[model samples]
Target: MRAAILQSSTGIDPLLSARNMVEAVERAAGEGADMLFTPEMSNLLDRDKARAAGSIVAEADDVVLAATREAAAKAGLWVHIGSLAVKADRGTAPYANRGFVIDDTGDIRARYDKIHLFDVDLPTGESWRESNSYVPGDRVVAVDTPWGRLGLSVCYDLRFPDLYFALSDAGATMLAIPAAFTVPTGRAHWHVLQRARAIESAAFVIAAAQVGHHADGRDTFGHSLVIDPWGDVLLDMGEETGLGYAEIDPAKIDEARGRIPVLAHRRALGAVEVAR
Candidate 1:
């Protein structure tokens, strides 16, 4: 399967970002890609919640989602908009960082809200309290695609191996871990974590990321990557903001799983007893 990874520099303006994404959809379709993957917060990325509130809306009312769906149908290309800030169905938190899988016909195939909210005070002096604005999702989503059963996840979710385990346990052959990571963390752990996820799951891992400075005055680490099941990097779009394509062979999934056989050997262990 030909996958197009869009490493984007998101802006505070949702409408402008939506237009840019539409153009990218056309480009991906023209390049003959089967699927297009975008970075997290593709619609808007503003650090200031007060200013961003005007742009964030319900999933049905979001112009970015609407535009991307229309573009997907027009181009006859599958699209995965990494995550859009949308109004949550039920929560004290006003919004949800949600990902979408849109089919070639402009139909939404699946929706996955970010479950693991990033609540940390980083050493680099960048503190993120995602739970403040967005509520966590209860469901784990695995969807069917032309390529294979694809698992859906968002930015901070990459750090949780148990999520990947659940996805693979659910019979996912490939994983989409789109992110908008901070620069300090990305420089230190991005590549290693992505490779580890692929190696552990024995599945293809595609991560499209946000890069460089944004309209909101924050910086992001931008190395959008694609890894095969054997932990080999297939495509790594370094720093620059643009589109990167990679070919995913379903056969590789079988080959890696057959060699490692870890998935088969996996056993459910009981809670550990404290040595103390």
Candidate 2:
């Protein structure tokens, strides 16, 4: 299976972003990518709380989601939109930071809302409280694909290893992380952490990320990568605002699992007594 990772500059213009993503998908398809992915907040990213509040909408009625589904169908590939802010619940103000998996037929196969909220103050004086604007998802989402079982996650979720372990326990072979990671955090922990997740879970890690500065004056570290089961980056989309592609070999999954039987050597940690 071939994969395409897309990176884009941030903008208030959701329509333009959608168009750019469609074009990128087309290009990746031309390169024979079976799966295509976009970075977090691929539709829009506005740091202004008031602006993001007013601009974000609910559901596929949002033009960007509609265009993405159409693009996925046209390309006949698995299209993963990292995360988009959409309306949730009734008449509520906060939106859902959701990720979607669209199949070749353009049907939404699975959806995962971001579970880990980025609510922290960086040492650089940059503070983010995502929970202030979005509602967290309560469920863990995994989907079965032609390639293998896939686990879905978004930005900030990368820091939580238990989630990946849960998905791996459920037979996930590939993990998707669509993110708009801050430059500070990405620089410090991005690649190493991503590789660690792949190595620990023995699963393929495909992270598509936002790159460059946004209209909101926020800059994201763009280094979209696809790592194999052995924790090797198959494709890296440095700092460029474009797309990258890689092939997925399911046999690699078997080979890695066979070499180190970490998944099989499981002991009942649940029965362990905690030391007071």
Candidate 3:
């Protein structure tokens, strides 16, 4: 299967981002791509809590989601809309960082709300409290598609290996980690962590990233990467706002697992007593 990864910077406006995404979808379709993957916060990227809360709408009312679904149908390709900041139900939740899988027919096949909220205080004086506005999802999602079984995850979830292991155990052959990572952490841990996940899971890792500076004065590390099951980098769109294409072979999963067999070599850990 051939896939196109979109690496772009999203501003505070969802409408403009939708337009840009549509163009990229068209280009990917022209290049004969079977699917297109985008980055986290593909709709909008604003740090201001009030502005974000006011600007974001429910999934049904989001223009970016509607436009992308139309584009996916028109292009006849699956579209993985990385993640969108959505206003959740009034009483149950404040907001949701949601990811959508749109099929070639413009139908939503799967929806995964990001489970891990980024609550960190970086040494660079950058801090985020994602839990303040968005509620965490308690489920791990893996869905079947024409290409293969896919595992869904978002930005900060990359730091958690257990989630990936659970998805792989659930028969996921490909993992999608769409992110809008900060420059400092992205530069430090992005590639290593992504490659590690691919190696450990023995699955193809497709990470479409948000790159460059946004209208909200936030800088993101943009190196959208596609890694094979064997931990080889297939395509890397470095720090640029564009589309990167890669060919995925499902057979690679079996080959990698056969060589390593780590997934099958599981054993329960026994209790350990303190040395004191």
User: lDDT winner among the candidates?
Assistant: 1
lDDT-best of 2 and 3: 3
Q: How far in Å is the alpha carbon of 269 misplaced in model 2?
A: 2.0
> lDDT per prediction?
0.95, 0.87, 0.93
Candidate 2 lDDT by residue in tens digits, 1-276: 888888888599788887887888789889988888888887889987777766688785777888988988988878888888888763243788989899998999988889999999999999999887788888899999889999999989999999998889989999998899999999999999999889888899999999988888999999999999999999888899887778899999899899987678754366767799
- The Cα RMSD of model 1 versus the native structure comes to 0.8
Which scores greater on TM-score, model 1 or model 3? Answer: 1
RMSD of 3: 1.4
Superior candidate under TM-score, 1 versus 2: 1
For model 1, how does the per-residue alpha-carbon lDDT over 121-201 read when each residue is reduced to its tens digit?
988788889999999998999999988999999989999999999999999999999999999999999999999999999
Per-model TM-score, in order, reads 0.99, 0.95, 0.96
Candidate 3: where are CA atoms >4 Å away? 90-93, 268-276
For candidate 3, report its TM-score: 0.96
Q: What is candidate 3's lDDT per residue for 55-105, written digit by digit as tens?
A: 799899999999999999999989999999998764356889999999999
